[model samples]
Target: PLIVDASSDFFSRKIDFSNIALFYGGVQKNAGISGLSCIFIRKDMLERSKNKQIPSMLNYLTHAENQSLFNTPPTFAIYMFNLEMDWLLNQGGLDKVHEKNSQKAAMLYECIDLSNGFYKGHADKKDRSLMNVSFNIAKNKDLEPLFVKEAEEAGMIGLKGHRILGGIRASIYNALNLDQVKTLCEFMKEFQGKYA
Candidate 1:
């Protein structure tokens, strides 16, 4: 079965799922909520359970048959998801959202590219992610912690990268506006000027 995990890019753009048997993702990233996972399964695929011995709670067919109400749901999170959907619709849907996301990511990538080697991007240019921009100091790697500290002081929280990566990561999710991104770019410039 062709299953996909769209955790990062969910709702960021249009996806062609014609060949997918199951598409699922957590709503916390782009969908503006937590504690809920959205799943889409082809109807015919539900008939091919891995085992009939599987418990109802773990069975795809059980949940599908019950319309996703086999158990109690996170009511508040579901409501927030609905509100987020309305927001996306009000903003003219995924196409428009995708454009904004692309613009935001490009602005950050440009900052990294024009940093004069002060900042280096982790991903190759073409393989970069629109949702999260990961980068680090090009020369003084020791200053990464200080950078994250100063960024938080400037009211830009959560710029810390993953523990394994141990650098800077700015998550430019759907909720961030272009002006906010510009502010971050400005911060990057000022930070570079201070120490570069």
Candidate 2:
């Protein structure tokens, strides 16, 4: 069966699920509060798990049969997901959400592009992600740690990059407002002035 793990960009925009067998993602990043995941599987796919020896928790058919109540669930997380859905609907659905996310990502990329070689984005312009904007201190690579520290001090946390690909990664999720992104871009400018 075809399975998709769209953990990062799950609810940011509308998806064409016409032929998708299964779509799943964590609620932490773009969907809702943490501690839960959302899944959408075709009924035909669930039939494949029926009469199988798989554990109840591992069997999609089991959960489908029990209406997703086969065991204790993350009730609070589900409630929050509902609330997030309400918010999304109030904001005019995924099209509006995608527009806001695109604006936020564009603002960040513009900051990186205009940094005069101080900040170098990791992704090419064509492949940049709306969820995470990653970059490095082009002038002095060693200053990334200090940049993270100072960014935290300035009340902008979670800018550190993954260990394997060391740099700055700013996650602009659905909950992050445009003003917060402006704050990040402002911080980038101020930080560059202080260290560049």
Candidate 3:
């Protein structure tokens, strides 16, 4: 069985694909829009892919042989991915990007952690997400509606939590620069002061 790394989870925290048999992630997660995915497979793993009889379209070796030009590619999406990669590299590669991501997550998480019962973080401290900071209002949970409403009114959007895990999910993706995170954090502080 090939070990798979779904880089969606802790990718921003750290990325070390060397030890994995396979790794994959969608650009939608951080790089760009949807309809694009990046995958990596070890050379030995590819050579040993047991199912040689599988159709070429379903074979990694075939794609590798053709440099992923086995068929028409998602040209536009790939272009966008390249642009994003260039931007990230220009900003000092993964090290600097990860540093900024960590800082942004920290700013938002700190706001949640220091709210003194006004905001309650969803994940455990050790398990908190660096990409999506999920949390909720402590006392008047009902005020979550008002909170989301006011946040939207204040020019911030996409803070509502999923239904399965209702609350707020501040997605601090790589594309979001530090200034944006600071604004969100500032809004969090102002909202807490007024409503908490």
RMSD versus native structure for model 3: 2.4
Clashes of 2: 0
Candidate whose lDDT is highest: 1
TM-score computed on alpha carbons, candidate 1: 0.95
lDDT of 2 at 161: 98
Model 2, residue 85: distance off in Å is 1.1
Which lDDT values do the candidates have, in the order given?
Answer: 0.93, 0.92, 0.82
Report the C-alpha lDDT of model 2 over 5-67, residue by residue, as the tens digit: 889998998888987899999988987888999889998988887865898789888888899
Model 1 — which ten-residue stretch has the worst lDDT? Answer: 43-52
Q: Per-residue lDDT for 62-167 in model 1, tens only?
A: 9988888999988999999999999999999999999999999999999999999999999999899999999999889999999999999999999989899979
How far does residue 38 in candidate 3 sit from its true spot (Å)? 0.4
Instruction: Give the clash total for candidate 1.
Output: 0
Candidate 2 clashing pairs, residues 3+ apart or interchain: none
Error of 1 at 52 (Å): 2.7
lDDT of 2 at 97: 97
Please report the candidate that would top TM-score against the real structure. Answer: 1
